[model samples]
Target: MRITLSDLNTKDLATLVQRTITTSDLGKYAVISNHPLLSELKKVYTEYDAVYTKSTYSGKGTDVASADRDRDVSFRALKNFLDGYRKMPSLSNYQFAEDLYQIFKLYDLSLDKMSYSSQTAQMKKLIEDLEKPENIQKLNALSLLPAFNEMKSKQDVFEQIFAEQAGANANLRNMKSASSIRKDLEKALRSYINFITVMKDVTGWELFYADINELVKAAKNSTVADHEKK
Candidate 1:
């Protein structure tokens, strides 16, 4: 029942070790080769396998507990080995970080759009249901008047955060130097102001104080703007 680290594939081994170490209370690995955390996990997994083998009476397959324990121990040991491999200095790569960030951002945007569409569909359904006189009366009596209002509030917050993050990313993309970065940041602020102006058509005075003119004034005070003007 004892599974050696060499028997498992590199990726599987790393994943198991990573999960175990992350869940366990352990300090950071000091020496890349002798990762104490991974070593401890492997030891635990080995002991687990030994206990399972003894309980199972040497592969006679006595019960489910023995089978489950053996499987769990093997998985954990393989995972620890893999985790140790990842902790090795040769495995660190910055491109992986960048790729992961882009992947997560795409996922976030997709989820946001899906949520908005779902809410819109739900509102449509509610309106349709309320068309019947009885349902309308019931809805009013049950105080469901605030359901759409709450949805609107939640959507507004989502939009605000999404827009702000998008604007920040756009500003970062446009940045060439420290001066250009400052200018782009100002431009981003103005873009937000323009967004509010457009929103005013729908929200009216609720967003009236958000003026693009004020952003223009703020941009005029920036050293980057002064340099560009010159």
Candidate 2:
């Protein structure tokens, strides 16, 4: 079944996007063999690594030099990985899923310092703030986190696309039975995995490529199963 953005309810779409973004590895993108950002960051980090490596060699004996060189290599690798955090791709004018995915991934990383409860409270407050019409305008005009921001920024857009859009207070709902709803959900998930493959060639996110490939394989191989009742 073909699934467009309209096929998903805003809440479900938001949830899916949030879940995927949080789990993605943005630092891995910089290791993609051909990414421009990787090339750029490589030059910067190579110079940095050279300086640190030289420091390890100063007045060091042969045995110490050999061991220090090994340590230096490991240190440089860690630096390269961490550099990706500093060089996170900007989110402005992001038109592709890969781009948006990276943006959301980075934004989640920024919240790592917060406790779980604080993070949840902040997210809840953010959602409440976004529900206002004025707040929605602010979101669209400003550069916001991809999934979280776009959901609010495009709330009206979703409404226009989905003719039978579900909401907290939709009196004339497009009611579907439990089975049909489940089927639609399954189809939607399948579509998402298929979509990921289409955009999988994206660079600057190599760390996440393996995980995404695994997700695609799992999604494709998964079958719907009935649960036994006690």
Q: Per-residue lDDT tens digits of candidate 1, residues 1-230?
A: 01233333333333433443343223332222243533544554443333322321222223323433443343233224333443554544433333322332433322323444453344344334444565444334434335424434444444455455556556544434433333333333334344444545463323232332333334334434445667
- Put down candidate 2 lDDT per residue, 85-168, tens digits, no spaces: 335447433233333233334445333245434433443454564446754444344433343444333433333333232231
Give the 10-residue window scoring lowest on summed lDDT in candidate 2: 221-230
Query: lDDT, candidate 1, residue 110?
Result: 28
The TM-score between candidate 2 and the true structure equals 0.22
Best by the lDDT measure: 2
Please give the distance, in angstroms, between residue 148's alpha carbon in candidate 1 and its true position after superposition: 3.0
What is the clash count of model 1? 7
Which one is best on TM-score? 2
Error of 1 at 130 (Å): 8.0
Clashing pairs in 2: 28-206, 28-207, 29-204, 29-205, 29-206
